[model samples]
Structures are given as structure tokens and as C-alpha cells.
Target: MNYDIFNGDADGIIALLQLRLANPINGELVTGVKRDIQLLEQVQVRPEDRLTVLDISMEKNSAALINALDVGADVFYADHHRCGDITQHQNLQAHIDLDANTCTALIIDQLLEGQFHLWAITAAYGDNLIAKADELATKVNLTKVQAEQLKELGTLINYNGYGSNISDLHFHPADLYRALLNYPNPFDVIIDTNSPFNLLQTAYQQDMDNALAIETKHTSACLSVFELPNTAWARRISGVYGNFLANQQTDSAHAVLTDNNDGTYTVSLRAPLDNKQGAGDVCSQFETGGGRAAAAGINALAKSDLPNFIKSVESHYLV
Candidate 1:
């Protein structure tokens, strides 16, 4: 009973695809929408069955994972997320790489000696580490046009993971996987013109339209706050909007705040690119948020504290 559990995003599915292309395996794919992070628990791996976990972090499900390992199933784990120590187990072989440039597909590429480098590029691009992916793509001799195509598909797939739930996404990730299965490379997927990629691009542009309509507060010298309407497009597109606004107005710290389903607001904060002087520390002042120097995300803040949240943002990032 061989079983595969993965992230269900392009990185997750194509990470499995890379492994399969390099070394064929017989297994059942256990996957769903992106929020289904606790996927490994559902798998029934016997003592004799082999399990391969891709992209998902073990720490996110430590108790269940240790239980499975105790049951005598062999596990091959490949991921690039933040996870604790890999316990010594006769049946477990860990291929975890935490480098920010690393993705599960890139880890599989290393195991396969670049046999599926193109797919690795796509995964990396979709993860928004474009510089890292582009550097790797040059080694494989990807033309400028081909590299851009891969980047587009990568962004499209990543955007597909934005929603709080699967229904909020433009298309189900599994449905995107089926369409991708027809093409070995993204170049083939993009050139079809009538491909699902087109549908995704259209939706992405529409989201951008909604994002462009947001109004900003300019509450402080370092922080600019844009309170957004409560809509699927708003929730799905806020982070992207934050990134875009920060880039456009390079000097000011930008925060994209969206009204959450719970009547609270979700905030995305970005640090200035020049100084790497960041404000995740400030976000932690409120509930439901944590991140590092350059980028950080906050889940939900009460509407009542919206003024206080703005004041905190002002004091933290303002010059």
C-alpha cells in the first residue's frame, strides 16, 4: 500500500511529478485544496507500505506523524518549510532543506540530478522566489520567452492557492493539475491560447482590477494603510496588492487591510526593501500575526481596534 501526500499546489503536485518522472512509483495521491494542511493524518500506511510526503511540513502535524512512524511505516519526507528536528528512525529518510531559495520541487531535482529541472523552475517561480528560479533556469538553457512562460504559469498556480478555502479559489488545484498533466512543460501550457492558463490569467487580471480600486489612509510617514471591502477578491488579493503598493511607493511602508468574514480585518504588512528594516514586531502587538524582517501577514484584528492598529503601524514604521 504505497501512498503519496502532498500540498496540492503546483509545487506539491509537480514535486510529486518530478519524483515520478525520475523514479517511477506506484501510489495513491492524497491531496485536496491548499488549506488541507493536515493531509498525512488521513493516509493509512501499514508497516509494509511506503509513504512519501512532499511540500507539507511535519511539524504542522507532529503528533500524528510520530504515531505513524511508531506503526512501522517507512517515510520519505522532502520539504523546505520550518520544521523541528528530524528524529532518527530506521524507516524514515528526510530530505528537508530550509534554504529560502529551496522548494520541494528543487529538493526532488537534487535527488534526480536535474532530470526535471524545468518543473523545478516552475515551482520556484510559483513560490515567488523568481530570482532564485531564474538563476537555475539559465543553467538549463531556458530561452527568455520560455522562462517568462514558466514564470507566468508559476504565478498563476500560486495565485490559485490564495483563498481561505478551496471554493474561493479561481479553480480547484486538482482541476489545475489535470490540465497541467497534458503538457510536459509550461511553454506548452501557455501557447495553447485556449488553455486553463488563459482562464487563470483573466481571473488574475480581474482581481488586480479590484485591487487597483482600493483607497489608502497614508496614516503615517512610514506606513500607508488601505482598508478593503469584504469580498473573495479582496481576501484573495490583499497580499498581492500590498506587494504592488509597496513597490510603487518605495519610500512608504504599505499595509493592505481587508475586512475578514468574521467582521474583523486582515492585515498584510511589508517592510521597506532598501533597509530590510521591518515591522513584524509591531504586528505582534495585536493578536493573530507573526513574520520576519522583509514580509509578514496578520490573520484577523477586530474592527474596534482598527484605529489602534493604525496607530501601532504608524509608530512602528514611521520615521
Candidate 2:
């Protein structure tokens, strides 16, 4: 059987979307919330099983990957996150670029030779590589209005991936991917009145409004932090809200912490836009935390460690 395991976020979803569109596959889809990156372990790989994994950190799933390869399963992996030590196996085909400016979809774009360039651009936007996406859009001769449309669509799709779990999300990422597969061109989804974009847009605005009303928990020259309540809206809006905060102040790092209601907080950390390095490093200092350098997250952080988390962010960016 073919297994398509990917992060539920825009970069992961769109990366697989572009690949499947280029090479059709009827694979079992495995995904969860954006923070759920240890996806390879869920699949029971057998000999000859084909797996396409994207946008998830290989370090966290190394053992499972080794198991899959040992079992003679073929694995194609692509990601931009921290990959510890990659296992060299004849059964594995890995495309990993750790550059802060690139995402998995963009990597696939290069592989596909930009057949779905527009969707790749949208994924870049959704991943909050705004300046890079804009540069690509201009190179393609997209008008300002057209670029904005893609950005909005990308942002909304990204917004849908935030939740603490699939229950908090407006659409399960698998369903969203299937719905999007019908439109090879992203613009068609934007133009379609009945598309997921419309539903996500409305939901995004409402949740964002609620987030905007909350005051910052802490702010300084190097960092700013916002603590959100333990509610569906708060969980749903945390990651994108961190991106919004980062865009608002490019020189300062931003952290959006949502109460997980279990004496822990779900943390989304963004490095300063001017210096897109060290986010993953800082988050990795804690348990249940890992991601790309420009953007990283902690799935559950204890309240006691909150101060240390802030101190870590400040110390990294203060320099």
C-alpha cells in the first residue's frame, strides 16, 4: 500500500499536493494538527510499501524511518525542518533544505520545475515566507492584486492547520487536501465561491479578532509574548497569530502561548524577521519542542518553564 504522511500545515499539504498532481498516487493519508510532526511512527510499513513524507522533522522520526527502510519500503521525504543525522539507505530518497527562506513546497517546486509554481508561491505565503513569496510572484509577473489573493488564500489555509488537534480545526487536513486536489490551479479555488477558502476566511477573521483584543503578556525590545486562553479559538489562532505578530514588528521575536488547560501552554515562537535564525534552537531547548529556524513550536510547555522559555528567546535575540 502507498502511504502519504505529511504535516497538516500549508507547506506539508501543498508539497504533497504538487507531488501527487505531478505523479498520481492513491495513498493512505496520515496527518494531524500542524504541531503533530512525528507522523512516520503511525504507519505500519511493510515490504514494498511506498511512503511519501513531507514537511516533518526527520530527527524526530528517525527510528521509524529506519524501520521503514529496513523493511524494504520505499520512502521519499522532503522537509525544511531540523534533521538530526539522516540514515543513508538505498530505499530512501530524501530532499531536505534547512534554509530559513525555503519550504518543502518550494523544494518540490524546483523538482517539478515549477509546473505548479502558483501553488508553491501560495504555500510560501502560508508558511509566512512573505517577502520570498512576493519576490517569486513578481518574477512570474503576477499583479499586486493577484499576489494578495494568493497570500490571503495561503494564510487562510495555514490558519486552518493551527488547532491543538483536528477537532479544533475547521477542516481536517486530509479533507482539505482532497478538496484542494480537485483544483490543480490555486486561483480556481479562490474563484470558486464554494471553496474551503471562503469558510476559512470567515473563521480566520473571527478568531483573529478575538486574539487581537488580548493584551500582550510581556514585551521588550528583543521579544514580545502573548498568552491566550484555553479555548478553541485561542488554539485555532495561535500559530498564525504569531506570524501576524512577527510581521507587525520585524526586529523583535514573538511568542504566542495558548493555555493547554493541563498546566501547560502550547508555544509558537517566531524569530525576528531581520534575523531568521535560532527559533528552532531555542524551542528545541525544551521538551516537546522542535521546528524550522524561522519558526518553531513547543507542543506543551509547563507554566513553571514559561520564564525560562522567555529568557531563552530574549537571550538568543538580544545578541
Candidate 3:
């Protein structure tokens, strides 16, 4: 059996698209939303079964992934997430490249020599790496208007994956993959019969409304933290909100905290421009999580620690 696991966003879907276009009839394509990054545990693989993991970090799944390798499943993994360290495996051929400034599309573009450069531009912009997207789009002879349209399409499709869970999203990341696979160009996809654009547009509207309604706790002139009463949409809204604020200015940060059902809160942090320098290691103060300069997240944090959490955020950037 041949299996392909990919993220349900534009990049993940398009990366698989490139793979499929290059090698159609590869195998079954597996996918889920952004939150379903831990997708390796669900599959049952055999020694002869082949697996291609796209846009999901193997380092995050070192154990089950290692087990799959030990089971003799030949794997091809491609990702641009926070992969700590990829272990060596006989059956694994990884295309994992973790560059904050780059993404799976760029990796594919690098390998394919601009054959898919235009789509890669859309993916990069969707991932919130606009400068890189434009740099590549420029090389591909895309007009300014075309580049902007690609960016818009990228943002909308990516927004579709926002939501604490699938309930809030227009479709499951897997379903989104199916939708995207059906259309190589998102602009075309939006106008298609089975398009998921309506769902994405609704989420975008809701995000703007909710984000605007919330008040901010100031850390500095450019930074603010907004607390959302944890709902089905909180976890998914944080990244989108962060990106939203970033576009408003070059020096803004949005730390969105959602109160989870378990009395713990899930934190999704984003730094508007210099994400690397902003919120660099603020979450680690609790010994729970950490991320790069521009973005990071914490799995869980005690609600009672709100005071300490505020203090940490204050000290890291505002202080």
C-alpha cells in the first residue's frame, strides 16, 4: 500500500499536487487540518507499504515514525515546520527543510526549477512569508495584480484551516485537500462548483469581528495581548489574528490565549514583523513550550498562572 500524508492548507495540498502532477497515480493521499500535525499515529503500515509525509514534521513524531521505519515502511517526508532533529532511518528519504523564510513550495521550486514557481509563491504568501513570496513571484514574470491575487487566494485558503477544531473551519483539512487537489489554481478553485471559499470567507469575517471586539493588554507601543474566552475558534484564530496585526504595522505582536475545556489555556503567539525577535522565548518561562522568533505556541498552561504569564510577556518585550 502507498500512503501520502500532507497538511490540508495551500502549501501542503499544493506540495502534494506537485508531487502528484510529477508522479500521478502515486498512492492514497492522507491529510488533516493545521492542528492535526500529529498524523502519523493513525496509519497502519507494513514493511512493503510506502508512506510520504508532507508538511508534517517527523521530529515531532520520532517515536511512531521510528516504529514505522522499524516496520520497514519506506517513507518520504517533506516539511517546513519545527523539526528538531530528524533521525536517520534506512527506509526514510526526507525532504524536510525547516526555514522560517522558506516553505515546501520553495523547496519544490528549488528542485523543479520554477516549473511550479507561481504556485509556490501562493503557498509562501499563505504561510505569511510575503517577502519571499514576492521575490519568487517576481522571478516567475507574474504581474503585480496576479501576485496580489495569489496572495489573497493563499490567505483565504489558509484561513479556512483556522479554528480550534474542525467545527469552526469550512471543511476538515482533509476535505480541503481533496478540494484543492481538484484544482491546481486556488483562484480557479474559488469559482469552482465545490469550492470551500464561502467557509473561508465566513471564518475571515468572524475573525475580524471577534479580534476587533476584544480589548488589548498593552505590553508596549507595538505589542498587545488579547484573551479570548476559549471557544471552538480560539486556537485557530490566534495565528490569523497575529498575521492580521502584523499587516497593520511592522512592529506589532498578538498573543492570543484561549481558555481550554480542561482548565488549561492554549497559547498561540505571533510576532507581526520581526517574529524572531518578538516573543522569542516568552512561553518557555513556564517550561511548557517554545517557538521561533516570530511565532511559538504552548500546549497547556495553568489558568491560575495568568498573573505570571502576563509578567513574563511584560518582561520579555515590554520591559
Highest TM-score model number = 2
Q: Is candidate 1 or candidate 3 better by TM-score?
A: 3
Considering every candidate listed, which one attains the maximal lDDT? Answer: 2
Pull out the clashing pairs in model 3. Answer: 275-293, 275-294, 276-293, 276-294
In the predicted model 2, the residue pairs found to clash are none
Once all C-alphas are superposed, what RMSD does model 3 give against the true structure? Answer: 2.8
Which residue segments of model 1 deviate by more than 4 Å? 24-26, 217-226, 239-255, 266-319
Query: Please, what are the lDDT tens digits per residue for candidate 1 over residues 14-43?
Result: 788777766667677777655465788898
Weakest ten-residue segment in model 1 by summed lDDT: 272-281
Cα lDDT tens digits, model 3, 1-319, are: 9898877766777777777655666577677656566788878878899888877666566787888999989888877766667878778887776566877767876766666566678888887888888887787788998888888778877776656667767677766666666665556766665577666767777766876788875556646677777666665666667677666676666677777878887777776576445453676566455554566667677888877876676666652
Q: What is residue 141's positional error in candidate 2, in angstroms?
A: 0.3
Clashing residue pairs for model 1: none
At residue 181, what lDDT does model 1 achieve?
66
Give the local distance difference test score of model 2: 0.95
lDDT of each: 0.74, 0.95, 0.71
Say which prediction, candidate 1 or candidate 3, comes out ahead on lDDT: 1
